[model samples]
Target: MRNDFSNYFNNSSENKWYNSSYIGVSLSIPVFDGLQKRSKSRQAKLEYTRTGLILDNTKERFNVDFKNAINNYYNNKTNVERQNQNINLAEKVYVETALKYREGLASMSDLLQDEMGLSNAQASYLNALYNFKEAEINIMSLNGEIKYLINK
Candidate 1:
């Protein structure tokens, strides 16, 4: 019994401890996953492309709208200037006609006509001013300065 106990306890192979750690590298390539990974990759790529298209479309739309707003603003500004000139001309005509009527050189009908022309010119100027302001607001909106308009 003593020899058997000594053999069991004192054997080098049985009593020795071995380190189990090891360092190694291995690569595993997928053979088949029911095409789920492929489908996911395809979906991701499609979404990326769709997003790019949407971004481009948005940019085009914004550019067109901005151009239209600018055009409208300039047209309205010109109209306002033209209307102002018309108002000034009409005022001069009315004053001259009034003086001629007082001197008995212009008929009452001529004076009335001049007054009507001045009134129409003033009304047109007011309308043009309103349209110009509206166009200016649109321009400000397109330029993303709408906040300044609100503050004003």
Candidate 2:
């Protein structure tokens, strides 16, 4: 409804015109409330599905890393054990050669050669020990079981 009271005035008094005022009744109409809910639910479900997939992948990666760490631990243990055996055999040979030399059955050169072989074997053993320790540390770290001597 629009009303202008200035129209009731005479021409001379109506020189100032009053603006028409309007009162309106309005209603907000939703075009598709049901469709909006369906779309939002679908979008949420898709996001949830994506998050699940990402979590699954993360879990799989963790499992694979754990398995790899276990494999490395076993392999390192085997290597160290083999190296220790070789070192023991080399030590036995060195001792036998030294004894043979003392008894005048083997030359000094043979003793020295055995000594060198034993030294090389000891080096290999030490290297294997270090590798084993490193692998153990890696496995501990992977399993989240590493404890620091000095905690900060």
Candidate 3:
């Protein structure tokens, strides 16, 4: 009886100790949380779409602006060239008129008219040069190379 009682006590103590050292792993899957996670995911997706759309719109606007800038640059370049030609022609005419006036072949009025034409041509050339430079700056800006152009 004593042995049996001692063994029972020993077994009970061992069982208690073993049970105290128990380790358990549990997995908890969320079933419902007021749809907060779902809402956050939806919001994130919407923000992503909005960002993409903004990027696309900006790209389109940039393309259009670049095209317009290029067109203006070319137009101004042609105008500058035309104005330069006009200046050259006007200078030649003025020279010819001055020679004729000295030889008594051209009247003072004709010589003055040629001088006025030359002056007008020079002014137009300067204006065209200013416009061409402005257009060049615009082109450089549209190409994102304004700094480079300026530095050069």
Candidate 4:
């Protein structure tokens, strides 16, 4: 509803007071401007595609990392086994060298070298064992990634 009213300030012979009434109905229909709705729709589609791509890339990376971790775990485990075998072989050689040295068939230097080789084998075994443990830890980290993905 709307209203308008007025009174004449100067006197006139026509009339001193006036009254009027009016009633009207109006309708306003909105129209799109500048293709804003289409632009917004395209933007929403692009955003959805971008978000899906990001998730795909993240999942791909996780798969690669998980596979690599498992491979490294197995490889390090094999290395540890090889190193353990080396330790055993070195021990046997050192014992033989010691027996020869006692019976005068091997020199003290030979026995000492064999002992050092055994010690080095033990050190290598320890290093390989450490690598295996590290690989295990890396494999375990995949669990955390799984939890994150699940929550997300």
- The most accurate candidate by lDDT is 1
Where does candidate 2 stray beyond 4 Å? 1-29, 33-37, 147-152
> Which 10-residue span in candidate 3 carries the lowest summed lDDT?
13-22
Tell me the TM-score of each prediction against the true structure: 0.73, 0.69, 0.73, 0.75
Against the hidden true structure, what lDDT does model 1 obtain?
0.93
- Distance from true position, residue 124, model 4, in Å? 0.7
Which candidate should be chosen as best, given TM-score against the real structure? 4
Better of 1 and 2 by TM-score: 1
lDDT of 2 by residue, 55-87 (tens): 999999999988988888899899999999998
lDDT of 3 by residue, 3-78 (tens): 9988887877655543356689999987889999989999999999999999999999999998998899899999
| Model 3 TM-score, 2 decimals | 0.73
The TM-score of predicted model 2 comes to: 0.69
Which parts of model 1 have CA positions greater than 4 angstroms off?
A: 1-32, 148-152
Alpha-carbon lDDT of model 2: 0.87
CA lDDT, every prediction? 0.93, 0.87, 0.92, 0.90
- Which pairs clash inside model 1? none
TM-score winner, 3 or 4? 4
**Which sections of candidate 4 miss by over 4 Å?**
1-30, 145-152
